[model samples]
Target: MIVDSLDIQKEIPLWALGDGEKVIQREFVFENFKQAFEFMTLSAEYAEEIDHHPDWSNSWNKVSVSLSTHSVGALTKLDIQLAKAMDAFASQVNSKN
Candidate 1:
């Protein structure tokens, strides 16, 4: 089921573009390309383990991510869970800087 924007905002302060949309978005910036790639590696592993992949792109030290459940045609619990996990991964990478 699609989640409410209010609940998602409360859960993830950094998430945006969730106003009746199928996706929730966030951008993570790292200290350098190496650090950014490391974040992607970690996030990719977790995403594969969970079987939920993000629609994302990387530009230099920045990673832009959008989470959505295409099968459901909306953002579901999986997107929220993955978003939280990605945020945690980004936090770890940021702290190592």
Candidate 2:
């Protein structure tokens, strides 16, 4: 599913991946670096499980992740699924810290 701007806005912290409109993006904020890394680890496991990788960065308490089904040249079910998994991981990390 192509994530439209409207849907993106409604979901806090998640934005349609930019990069010339070819991916899905989300930025998650945590209490500190430790929490952020924890989320990253969880996301990594999930990504590996599905064989869907993401472009991501982490600085202090913030983690930015971008997902794209490069082979398809657009956002697909995989992107949305990863986004949701990331969201879940973020919530889990936040609650612990």
TM-score of each: 0.94, 0.82
Model 1 poorest ten-residue lDDT run: 14-23
Candidate 2 regions exceeding 4 Å error are 1-13
Model 1 over residues 1-97: C-alpha lDDT tens digits? 6787777889988999654677899989999999999999999999999999999999999999989899988888888899999999999999996
Instruction: Compose the digit string of candidate 2's lDDT tens values, residues 1-97.
Output: 6666555556634565587767777788999899999999999999999999999999999998888888878776777778888999988888874
Given candidate 2, what's the lDDT at residue 57? 93
Q: Against the hidden true structure, what lDDT does model 2 obtain?
A: 0.81
Kindly give the number of clashing pairs for every candidate: 0, 2
Q: Which runs in model 1 stand beyond 4 Å of their true positions?
A: none
- The lDDT, on a scale of 0 to 1, for candidate 1 is 0.90
Candidate 1 lDDT at 43 equals 94
lDDT of each: 0.90, 0.81
